[model samples]
Target: MPTLTAYPLFRERSLLYLADMGNSKLKTSDSATAPLQLAREVLMIEAREVQALAERLDENFVNAVELILQCRGRVVVTGIGKSGHIGHKIAATLASTGTPAFFMHPAEASHGDLGMITQGDVVIALSNSGEADELLAILPPLKRIGAPIISISGNRASTLSRAATVFLDAHVSQEACPLGLAPTASTTAALALGDALAVTLLEQRGFSKEDFALAHPGGSLGRRLLVHVEDVMRQGDAIPVIEASRSLKDGLLEMSRKGLGMTAVLDEHGRAAGIFTDGDLRRAFESGIDIHATLMRDVMHRQPQTITPEQLAVDAVALMEQYSISSLLVVDQQDNLVGALNMHDLLMAKVV
Candidate 1:
């Protein structure tokens, strides 16, 4: 009857020995490196599996893409467990890439989500074993609805595959999991296959950057592609402008009143002649030029960088970066100053 603390050293050594015994290759002296070694092995296994899946691609893969392309309705992706998680991602990728698609849980399909399926729609089912009960339960209904089934499964002989309109094998030789229980390599292969399908469809449809921007209107991509200088530039009274005959002091006042750190210098004909920035003012003062006596036309930088109102805001950003300037004059086709913008404006619009 020894107390727990009476043999702490012996107990610690016993536990270490047991851990090493669990994996014959792992020893007490190098136990610290076990996790790193195992992680690398897992990645290698999954990578190899995906590579194998690529080489095994045949006409079945092509036929599946053709089927989805011909489908007039949405592509409905479904699965259970880990497969269901991968299915959800695949559906999102497809939908965002121009192919109309959605994810429907297999278990939910049996409980009335099946009504979402239409005759013209296409179904992509994911199941490593090809015999998931939840997925299998929905197959007959999916078939009855006249939707074509594209099954991605490890077992071609499984019921799900046999019932498919086109079966693409996503088989992997082994799991990345040390115990060979978790769906690691298999899920990786399935996800890669799904990506291939989505990208192929995207290319086939000639999906463009503008189309992608439309789907992601709230994202940064949309801002860069969809937003124009006219949408973010300061217009009307907000634009700081002064006639060429105006003094540098007048230009400074306009710049301050408009709070843009620069003023547009307009010619007698009311067209943009040049620009007077704070940098010019500083240089004028350093050169001992009287601000009140110097005309804007004399002190302003001639032929300042300008952008068209219809130009993309991202292009304006590029122009600013290329010239190492912060502000830009927005002009019309006739080079008339219609608006103005600075780095701050682009920052506010999140275009920078």
Candidate 2:
């Protein structure tokens, strides 16, 4: 008898067998390339499925969207298992994109949560097989409430699909899972279908980026999209202003008092002559100009950066960045100085 470890041929064969099993069970560096190819194939298959759904979109799809748009109540999406996860995401996407929607677990809905649905609401149910027992069990109660059902599933003949007022076929050719057991391609198809519905409804409703901002006021997009210069500018006494005949010392005093790092120098008629910023102060000091004797008109940078109060604050920030300047004088239609703002003002207002 020979020890298995001492036999070279046996050891080599065992190593090769282990490597083959590893490739089949876990995708490691040795099997990485094949999995990537499989992923591309799955994506292509899912994309085709989505395109098929898009092409088959007829008056029924139109009616579904119209139903949701006209409904005085929310859209309720429900599903079980992997579909439930997709339903949750779809519900969130719809809610954020101007559609009032929420996800209800079919199992939970049957267990007293069915009260969440009403006659005014539209229900979207997801079941790839269209035969989930819990989902099917809740269909009668939902239909009895007079809520229209939008079914997303592969099997059109299944109980849940047959119960729906409009069926959106989320059929896929194959699952990406090697064993064809997990919900991979099917979930992807369902998600894409959900996205299509959401985006279509969003466009039909004329959902603007501003509308999106209102839904997400705490995020950066809301700040960038909704904030106008008027909302962030320093108006009234907060503005640093001086007349043309004012001494440079007076301009500096206004800038210091307002703490905006600059002052707007107005002409005799109250229009802006120029702006004197801290940077301009440094230049004036280097030029040996006496702050007390020099008029601000003589030292100020004329035709300074100015923005309309109606301008978007994000655009104002772009102007500042492009000009490499920190402050802008805000003026109205008459060109009279209405306000002033700096990067600090934008920061304080959370518009930057």
Candidate 3:
């Protein structure tokens, strides 16, 4: 529970090095010398501390995950200082990964936000020293409401850990800070532990990508997974269409009018024969073909790729990326053109 620096040697050496550097520019500090070496040592120290925490994981982590899964209400996370900042991220991670959670500032809880905590809920209290006064103040109220307290703290015997329903040890031997006072290593360990807990609960709950999309409908991930081609495609008469016997000029007029850079060519049976694109027009011009008299089918790409409306928009993007095409023809179960969409549509819909 000591807040005192544990690595005097490191602190002493770092202080002496900084003193030698005086006011020299840190951006131009010699990579082989004191400044760079000091930064590396801090990183290595924090990294080692995190590895040590991971190596010490045991039944406590499993118990913590189980505690959360059994709760019928939201998980209320509470912490102070640096641990509080880490707690906010942990709560977000848990919520996004399918475990309902929210950060409840300990001070807010003391100031009557305690109403936010109710029965059947779980409390995740974070404090490295396990002596955060604001956090300790709410444990009795939480216990009285039949809520479980899960403590992530470095001190196993501290007041917070002793009062918890479950204790998760996140002890770090040293901080990345040379003074070992700012919570560098301990905060990282707590965050990593929180991630482990959230992921384990997510797997246990059988959380799916579909479920995630529902939780995050406003983001690109939702657009990719939830939006279908039918949602963004130009349907019915908006699709540019022409018969195979039509003049290339007729297809060009349809393309210009539709503004989709391409026109769908239908066969005599009214099924898709092929598609004539701007690319095909350029090739015809290069070959000196008669655009004014040639039939659409002769200059079009036969067996053009098409998609069904039920397919995901992201799948459509993948198809376009794979085929190197900006536009795609949408077909029905009967292999008839129903709609068309291009890269611009995807971009406008934010499905790109």
Candidate 4:
């Protein structure tokens, strides 16, 4: 009963909607309307297929998981054609989720890529009909290698399924293609089944967000999980540290020298008493205060936002955005000045 959404306009019938919309047969005026109907019909078919396949989970799925979990070497996934493409994605998902999987093209297997598999490995083969020639060509060697096979296919009686130690049923009722010639619904069903296996294995392995972050450490995730405030914040002389008793002129001299647009004001005990920024100095100028006479403590914002060195850089970014500030003063657990960073620093690190 799921509603259909957008679909492939032409020739991308891979997502359970591979129906051959013979544009050659349609009248020019009806062409525009034909695509819409085709899209809706194909989407509906795929969604239902995904739902139905999900409900058809059986003991074979459990056996597949058990085999994968018991694997000593990496899981080698193989398939041909459209199924090969889906198998590649499933392998990626499995690897990123801590299952340690890789795709081995069946045709490439015949070209000696089969050496990638060892007795310690497990193989997940994909084919809608379970009868691809390239897949069958490597079955004997796969069997000889003593590696267990988990097959995902539309036919229970397929050669691939019959050869497997465990067979996961990804059979779909129909293809989204009007001619039933393309691998539409069957492919999606296989993908969903593969996802289920990967996710189930992920949970069984106790995979965590920290583990996922390690697998993806280049972008915002790295900034959030790997880069700490101390790793990126300016420390030592780079931080404009001044005493609260100092005059605004001295603060200005320190600020101008450090060029962080701000200076931290410390108390007699060397704890952060307050902070004075370029914005604060501008406001002070507007108020006509004497730069030589005003104490930094009196001219500064007394309660400034601060973070610990152990905090995440992304957290610092969040704090900066929330308060609409350009810089943040890094503090210790004892509230003493330790380091500082600005939006520009975040930009340089690509953390923002």
List the candidate numbers ranked by lDDT, top first.
1, 3, 4, 2
lDDT of 1 by residue, 1-352 (tens): 2332433433444567787786755344445665566567678879999999999999999999999999999999999999999999999999999999999998888989999999999999999999999998988888788999999999999999999999999998888765567899999999999999999999999999999999999999999999999999999999999999988888888999999999999999999999989898889989999888989989999999999998999999999999999999999999999999999999999998
Expressed as tens digits, the lDDT of each residue in 148-257 for candidate 4 is 99999999999999999999999988788766778889998989898898889989999998788899897577557888889899999999989999999999999999
Stronger candidate by TM-score (1 vs 3): 1
lDDT of each: 0.91, 0.86, 0.89, 0.88
Off-target runs (Cα >4 Å) in candidate 1 are 1-28
How well does model 1 score by local distance difference test?
A: 0.91
TM-score of 1: 0.92
* Model 1 alpha-carbon miss at residue 38, Å: 1.6
Pick out the ten consecutive residues of candidate 3 with the lowest summed lDDT.
Answer: 1-10
- Count clashing residue pairs in model 3: 0
Error of 1 at 101 (Å): 0.7
TM-score on alpha carbons, each prediction:
0.92, 0.87, 0.90, 0.90
In order of listing, the candidates' clash counts read 0, 0, 0, 5
Residue pairs with backbone atoms closer than 3 Å in model 3 (clashes): none
Give the 10-residue window scoring lowest on summed lDDT in candidate 4: 1-10
The alpha-carbon RMSD values of the candidates against the true structure, listed in the order shown, are 6.4, 6.6, 3.0, 5.1
- Residue 278 of candidate 3: its Cα lDDT? 95
RMSD value for candidate 4: 5.1
What's the lDDT for candidate 2?
A: 0.86
